[model samples]
Target: MKNSKVFLSLCAVLFILPSLDAQTKRIKRPKSRVGVGSVDRFVQESFDLYDKVYKYDGYAAAGTPLDDDDIDVLEEALEEMTVLSESAPDIIDDLDGVGVLKQGKATLQMNKAKKALKYSIKTAKELLLGQREREAQENEDDTAETESGDSPDISGTSGNQKDGADVEAEEEPSNISDKLEVYSKFDFVPGDKLLYFDDFSQDFIGDFPSKWNTNGTGEVVTVGSVEGKWFELKGGYGIQFLPLLSEALPEEYTIEFDLLAVVDTKTSSTARLNLTLADNNEFRDGPNKSSVELPLGQFGAFSIRVFNRINGGTVINSSLNANLRQAVLNKPHISVAVNKRRFRLWVNQKKYVDIPQFIAPDKALSHIKFNLLGMRDGVDRLFITNLKVAEGGVDLRRKLMAEGRISTNGILFDSGSANIQPRSLGIVRQISQVLMQDQSIKLNIIGHTDSDGPDEANLALSKARANAVKEALVTIYKISEERLTTEGKGESEPVGDNTTADGKAQNRRVEFVKI
Candidate 1:
């Protein structure tokens, strides 16, 4: 009887298994019918136009009337923006931006689109105004010609052409002569030491990344013409992904990553991406004790939402409104600087959000995750790479005194060149100020590079770079040349992994050692 009962139970399970499988099959997600080809073409065209306009030397083309090609480019961009903004049917001008939100709010994407449209409209108007002005001038000239029997040459401009050409030539140097000049205004500087860095280079393509934990699996996929592998999020329900870090983030650290939003014709109409940083290591454990949400979309406006149980149960919410369409279409670099409760974030090169008190005074982020929360089907693609976390908020003088050396990724250089970028002036000035205060102090300037290309070449480059720094210190800051010595480490020492971009960037650095 016992044997019979056991056999019967096994038979029942086997019999029900097929039905369960059938039910699962019935509930399986349907493949998207809209192809990626249309999306690809749109992306390509948008990028091409943006790149051309962004790199165009407006100074060089000064006083030149809008040509047919220029008008066509602007028109194409205008048409695309119209389609993109209008693709979603429930399009309401709710001054507050796009996507699912606690309240109607504008997003970076929405603002960016609106700004682009505004520019196009303005350009179109300007073009028309210029045409009208030119026509009127022509008519006046024609009347003058009819009366005076002399027509001003179209090729000549009452000596204005020579003046314009001279002005154009002068402006050209400001644009090309110093590529690093703009960087002087870019105040962001990397942290003192590397904490955690990953570019996903070690992870095999098409497989779930080995170093990340996801409630639902995510594959490491490569995009066309894009370098490195990125984790792609795909599932019906939301997925949470966190790096395999042993401990929580430090009190003062910086985090940066590149984000790419993939849009398809089906999904681009109403796409949304939600990311959150929480104290909980795993979301599957239970409800979040504390968390901060960043929802990006609704035409590219992004909001920061925070909820903490420990810190007075206070909820803080804010939004950074700007034009960020290009940031979505292309890869946008996200940089977050955290100094305990204070948080500052930058998208691309623009500082959109700055919160002196971002989190509770007692709490810090333990893990960061990606989610497709409340997102509609179709626009569910995102690519991430070059993640870097480093300790910041350092006291330079204290560190130098304690360690007898100070290394910085601050002193930057042009790629493959020994020329120090102007952006390094801030750090350079700081160092010079310190030296000037202490005339007895002597220092050694060292240069290092990542293991890229050939070792001999890197060694040569490093030496040249070190010497260049020594020269800059002497000439620019008036630092004593006798007090400074130069050396090159090449790839002999590395604080980070060479295989990853973040690691490579960390490795290529300069150091000041007290001698």
Candidate 2:
């Protein structure tokens, strides 16, 4: 009976294989753009293989025993995926050399496919091993029962043990400290003095933020699994969202924010979120402005545009094709640094745009304006939080060496938590560099917080945050733990008023003091 069931399953697989092959053949290849078409087809086929392997892994993990036939099919799929992943780099190189596709476009997809293949292979192997072990044990039990002329015990002790092991593995939490090594090359240093900071914690849910102005509708809302409140801006052609600033922006400053987009890629292909630095903080676009327009959801190929208009005339109109589709859908940190005519931008840890003469040095870029274009009214959504602006050009190393103490609000953390924000690593990196250069420097790290929560809880959070910073230095930067000590003053040490947003931003700072 088992043999007949296996034969039927194999026959069913054989019938489905032809249909899959036919579907692959139906994909039309562009004759005029052979290289581009080949890449697109390759990516599609790789994803299809990945989906199959993922499903097979799920079946195996759900305690469903994969028979020999099923194992054979999974092995074949894994081999094909492995070949595709191994050939990706060479394929990307050839296409890039031919100028058939934009640089990094194919490479991005290749990297993603390779990563997926790696995890899928690992999962499939573990599941297959478990299945084989169970099969071997069952055979042994059958042999014993036949030899002793007794019925075998079928209480499923082995199966329960396997399920319990899987449960334990699933319950293990991932360590963020282990992931910080990837940011060793990250060099985005935030400005020294924070001019403005807002995580939308001060605003009520479903209400417009008091410190912001917008022509279109927007509300502060909390997103699932994301920390703090976010301002969700409605989509339209001429809609504009502006933060109310007391004074015009300086020539040198940095801006950082967290962005999340939830939209159907097919429908939101043409949607764009524009970050504009203009002369005024109003709903209307200023005459002189420099804008960074990012596409919301184009999965295949997309471009980031930087447009500059000075003296009522457009000067800089540049675009670079980048693979930011996945990053946009996931929560991505956006960082921008402006120094005179030079402008630079980073999405997460990767720097996407850097122009030497992008901004107009003559005009005062006072306001940061946000505008959404080409999105559906109710279907698409965009949210942004932790919007921070700070003055640039402070040399942290020099300041620390000369003054013996340096205070900075740039080392940010999660709301009411000790988890350090990844972007805040830039500031910590600089401090690490200073320590590396001078091993004799023993310093004390102090954490402070705004008076929003209870004193006892705030104090504990502050101490935990200070300890987190110390751990990052020791673990990630390999700094000596003996050279560092941590303390938290909490709301006891107040550098700014607790009533105002800017004041709260100032008060919540980390200070490195030489001891």
Candidate 3:
């Protein structure tokens, strides 16, 4: 009895542990290179089972009573599954590390699965053809009897009825390969780089501006036969992004393009240099519509307005700095360049925006978008083509962490106070959302700052801010303290240059790191 009880206890632990671990495991999702994949397995199996009944005599002879309508539905599902399976790998791989591979031994099996589904659909069509023939023959027989004004006395097979059924069954080929082919091709992958609306599809109903909703003169314009317009970027209008593309854009990368524009104005509007990277809190979430416009000047490398200052986040309207950028407006060539944060814009082969030891482009903006605000007033027209991308350089998140720049979880304070700000409410709200999704994971909110003030002052202030953030989340957000912790780092850590305005802004910020 003792041994039996021990065995039972062992079994109970084994049964409960795996489920408990799964609940606690943090999910890190890698980006999928390809979109669609093979169809769901159960769905494919259902198709195959029903399809065989329609094609081969073997299934018919087994005495199953499934109808033709059911057969039709199954065959259609099979076709769709084949397409999906071809695009998405995980749907069929059912294995760890399978989704990331380009091609492998497992991929071969997936190919077979796809082929089998295709054949299954083909078979079902053939069976449907046979059923239609049977119906036709019965009609023919009844018509003959009615016309003769007599009923047959004997029940016997007729040559005419058999001939009719054969003709009807011959109508559709169960072998899809010999009957028809399905294919998908694209001339252009249309849509904006930063923000995409629901209408980023071929359907007419989804192509509405209200859904994408841009502020200012930025209309959704269509230039020539280039087709549908999702975002029509107007000159001097800056667009703020909602935290898309992971956190920030990648650094040490080549951002090549496929853009279309018209530079018809001599106001240097034609030579608009588009700006893609901007870092500020005003553009983080709802900054009441901000913009950082790029003025692509005519014939000069990306340095004509090298020394200009108009500091409003991003906007449609430009102040004195708008004219300072010197847009030549009517240039007709799409440009490409490699940019470093400090290096700025390099146009037509020259180191422009030549600030020293600059910050690289924001890693949060790892997207395929262009900046077109600067030069193109009326004469500027650009047609974008051939999008190409490659990345290198230090990983932003890792670098920031190495230098104690950004923490995964951090406290936010109200501006200008060591005491926790009321606005840390936003950060608390987001943390609450994360906790709501994950029940087992724990969080730590550590605070840090730039070295503008004394070390003791900064450290104490950081602690106050951190504690305030903790209290608000626990008391107001109602998060359990068992899963929370807070700490403070004074002026000892710095993520950006303490000398520049942008760097100081980054330095004097909260950092959150997962423990």
Which candidate gets the maximum TM-score versus the true structure? 2
Deviation (Å) of 68 in candidate 1: 31
Q: Give per-residue CA lDDT, model 2, range 29-126, as digits (tens).
A: 11222335556666666656655655555454345677888777766665565566556656654442221123234444444444445545544444
**Which candidate tops lDDT?**
2
lDDT of each: 0.55, 0.71, 0.38
Per-candidate RMSD, Å: 22.8, 12.1, 23.1
The 10-residue segment of model 3 with minimum total lDDT is 179-188
Clashes per model (N, Cα, C within 3 A): 16, 0, 75
Residue-level lDDT tens digits of model 3 in 246-287: 334445543333244343334453354444443432323332
Candidate 1: segments with Cα more than 4 A from true spot: 1-177, 264-272, 284-312, 374-380, 395-404, 409-444, 464-486, 495-506
Error of 1 at 160 (Å): 23
- Model 3 spans > 4 angstroms off: 1-213, 217-222, 225-230, 236-243, 268-271, 274-276, 280-303, 306-356, 360-390, 393-515
Question: 1 or 2, which is superior by lDDT?
Answer: 2
Query: Which candidate, 1 or 3, has the higher TM-score?
Result: 1
Better of 2 and 3 by TM-score: 2
